[model samples]
Target chain A: MTKMHMVSALNNALDIAMKADDKIVILGEDVGVDGGVFRVTENLQKNYGEQRVIDTPLAEAGIVGCSIGMSLNGLKPIPEIQFSGFSYQAFHHIKQHMARIRQRTNNTMSCPMVLRAPCSGGIRALEHHSESPESFFIHCQGIRVIMPAGPYDAKGLMLAAIKSEDPVIFLEPKKIYRSFKEDVPEEAYEIELDKANVRKQGTDLTMISWGAMTRLCEETIEDLEKENISVEHIDLRTLWPLDINTLSNSVNKTKKCIIVQEATKSCSLSSEISAQINERCVLNLEAPIQRVTSWDLPFPQFALENYFLPNKTRIKNAVKKVLEF
Target chain B: MAQEQIGQFGINHVSILDKEGNVDEKLASGFTKEQLSEMYYYMNLLRKFDEKLFNLQRSGKIGTYAQTKGQEASEIGSGLALSENDWFVPSFRELGVYLTRKVPKNLLVQAWNGDTRALGNPNHSHNLPISIPIGSQCIHATGIAWASQIKQEKDVTIVYFGEGATSEGDFHEAMNFAGVFNLPIVFFCQRNGWSISTPTTKETKSETIAQKAIAYGFKGIQVDGNDVLAVNKVTTQAIEKARSGDGPTLIESITYRMGDHTTSDDSMKYRTQEEINEWENKDPVLRFEKYITNNNILNEQEKTDIHNAIEREIQEAVEQGLSVEKPNPEQMFEDVFAQMPEMLKEQKEELLNEIIQMSEQNNNGGNQ
Candidate 1:
């Protein structure tokens, strides 16, 4: 085991994948000599050469569109869009081509590419840097969307996404890229997608979240445990092919659910999860599925971001409402 | 260091054949009489196929179709320049390119009918499916060339798009990458004057689309797109340069959009008859046929035989395209992933159950 941060785990995964497969390539703006703006790709260009680890011009659409072409031509490209907000430039390629290529070409061709971007808020980043756009991708059919909350799952899920046949959107939580450390394995491994991780098991109420919000949910669960509130905390590692069976099972046991998300409340992944849980575990419900999420308004300036994002107090209140009901 | 004019860059316009069957013997030597005759045959065949598909759309047999009427030379000439091993990336309106690449005619028709199975490009064919969204395929072509370069392969990639695509950010980004990395690729821009309702003059104030490449650090050539010989000549040179590791070149074939953007659009709404009439006199196939007839390269009997054979072939292709069975509706949920995820599997089952119930109801009605 090696102690590493989320960025290091992702870099290590790329190194391992590139060394194993000659077809693997890495490209994005500032991904080469600058080693990405966050240095997540530091020293990779030197190791893999400039051809494989490319520093593209500042064009998100080109970076992604070219990567789709490379993927079509038997190259496993992991194109990085600098931020989730900036990924809108490539959304046309992502939705029109990357997600639909497999279905468009039938089983003849598949886009084995991973579009990596930093997502969610809390870093006090400038506009277009801190945004949780997972719902936009999760809503895109035929694309696998996965976000890792820590280093261990970061390496595993990164490897799994790189190795998947269809296109995968690997949204890395920028808030935790360097926030914490974990003992991640040096060897290559894969944590299966479409599976949820049970961070803590309880029976009073089920708290479901993913990405940065999972950390807040964990903290909220710990704080509520002091009041003998046995809140079950589930981190949904994969958002698209959601592990609803696990969520439904938890909801059946707890009889209540509260979804936490960093994105706006309308048509969010949280809304989908809540609807699914309602469909599966409505008879077992003790209260309505509450959502602790950001407001529907545009993400405000950095100073007001804390208020925009879901906090421990809001999550605790949601859990208390479900338990009290 | 004071900036001084160290060098001069000027765009060269190329045209090997005139509208009245006159040819430049010096530049026309590269093509054999037989090859020149074949180009005419293919160009005629493409027109016939396009006409048939337009009729099919009118009859509700297919969806919206993008016609490549006047721009045949720009598509076929550039497509024929690349070797078999090289890659071809096509925008939506490259019917001539698809024919030159030997993509099955039935599949092209099937694609217009909204069937995904029609896009099953043969294995190792190196031909990308038609990109409907304009300018997106340019970057794909650059990346394919970059991959071939990394693998030390001699293959060059050719990407096709219209003059209006130059306004897209993907085009600039692709050209910038090709210039900076020296990737082996060709950007074939058919400047067909109109992009839907907007004219090229409104799209960009630049005098020529070819000059856009100069800003990205490469050579750009303006070719008479209606002249098949000129399009083929420059494209061959560009492909050779790219394959030999000399980097990319942008060829802007100056043509006019003789047809509407697609079946759903009306050219009469945006363009003038005078402009269309001006381009009709410089028809690519007619010019090539004139040259062939003037040189006696293909005798009258041979020309008649080629036309008859192409008509027969088009008839067979139309039959095959119409006869192909429709794809199973359930196939939609099957290929979304390598393995259907649990959620999709449940949804598929739910759909299957509904389909079964509906079919059973139909069977009961038939019995009654």
Candidate 2:
């Protein structure tokens, strides 16, 4: 095992998948020569040649729609949409065709493809560059949503996404692309989707989050431990097909919980988790469920990005509020 | 600015048979009597199917249907040009193409009857299900061809859409990709004059839809859509060019929609009777029939026999479609995913239980 970043881990996963399966192809804008804007797919074109790693014209809907076609023709395509914000251009294909093809054809055909998009904030870029669009995809029934917080999870989840028989929206948090590193295995492995990983088991308040926010929650919990505060932390790997059983079990033990997310609080995945907990673990609660999330306002530019994101302080404040109650 | 011609592009329109049952002597030898007769037979079959399905919709036997009354030559000619290995990507109104491809007539009826099972992606067929959304299948055609090219497969892909579909962004995207990648695909746009109520002139200001391919850096040809021979000739060349790795080509078949956009639509609301009557004079089936008579390919007795045979086939297909069992309601919950998610599983169970309880209540009412 070697220390790797999220981008490299994802690249390795693509390489491994492509090597094992000749049908697997990678397509997106600037994904071949430029190796993507973030260089996550660096040198893939040279290694896999132009046919396997294609640099398609700048068209999100076309990229996705064509990927669905490739899937129907028995090719496993992993199409990247540049950024999560730009995926809106492909929402029609995603919602209408990609998500509906299997059910539309009634089991005879499946779009066994993966749509990879960089999601969420922190690296303050231009408008429409750093917004979390996971909430939009999580609402889609036929598509699976997989978001990874670190290198290990990113590699494993990406492999699983590529192998899945149904279409998957694999959202890689751009915030943590190079923020840290972990000793990820070089071999191909799969981390189960719809399962939560308990980062730190505590009997007190349960803190649940995923993607970039999960890392922030881990840091917040680490600092809280210095102050003699024990926090049960859970990283939700897959947002949809949510591990509600693990969530409610933890919520019941802690008797209080705080859900954190980088996306806006309105109609976010946090609201769904909060509601589920409220219904399933209602009698076990000692206080109302807390949601530490960004305000409903648009993601600000770099100058005021700290104000819009759910930082450690915000998460800690929610934890203290839940603990005091 | 001086009136200097910097560059020029030409659009060729081909027609082998004229309206008065006269064929160009030079092209007449290229087709045999049997092939010409087969074209007429398929054309007659498709028209009969169209008339039958429209009547079925009127009697509430089927859901809303899209009629291909006047565009038969464009669809059938292009479909016939394709080999069995080539993929046929279609928009909703390619009934003539499907019939020409020999897709089960009963399956078409079942699909129009709102049965999803009829549309299941059949491994045995080279055709995809009819796409209701406009212009989406264009991209799929490019991708399918690209995959075939990557695998070094010789099979070509032919995608059919109408003139209005060219307005969609997906069309431009697919065209650009096919041009850049040199994919083995054919973009067959039937310029049928109307996209629902909108005219072709309203769709674009360009002289012809065929010219749109020039901007994408590929060859585009225009054909007389009313002339089945012309459509077959152009499509055969385009398909051959793709199979030989010559890249993509766009063939714009100029035709007219003699029927309404669909059963629910009324052409009289948008077009004049004069225009409809003028187009009727150039009817593809009638022109082909005239050719068969003038060329002495089939006598009156043989023509009558072929017509009777087509009508019998249509009747049998309709009966077969109606006789099939209605799909199970629970199937709606399946096929969404390889493995149903917990949420869908719960909903499916809930629905099944509800159906059981309702049946028990009906039984109690029967006892009373």
Using lDDT, give the best candidate's number.
2
Q: Model 2 - which docking category?
A: medium
Tens-digit lDDT track for model 1 on A1-325?
A: 9899999999999889999998999999999999999888889999989888998888898899889888877788999999989999999989888888888777787888999998888998998788889999988898999999899999999998888888999998898999889999999999988899998889798888899888778877787889898988899888888899999999999898999998999998988998888889999998999999999989898999998999998888887788778
Candidate 2 lDDT over B170-191, as tens digits, reads 8999999999999999999999
TM-score between model 1 and native: 0.97
lDDT of each: 0.88, 0.90
**DockQ of predicted model 2:** 0.72
DockQ of each: 0.71, 0.72
Q: How many pairs of residues collide in model 2?
A: 0
Q: What is the C-alpha RMSD of each candidate to the true structure, in Å?
A: 1.9, 2.0
Error of 2 at B193 (Å): 1.0
Best-matching candidate per DockQ: 2
**Which lDDT tens digits does candidate 2 get at residues A1-325?**
9899999999999988988999999999999999999888888899889999999989998899889888888899999999999998888788888888887786787788999999888887888898898889887778889899999999999998888888999999998999999999999999987788888899888999999998888888889999988888899998887888898999999899999999999899999999989989999999999999999998888799998999988988888888888
Docking class of 1: medium
Residue runs of model 1 more than 4 Å from their true location after superposition? B1-7, B361-368
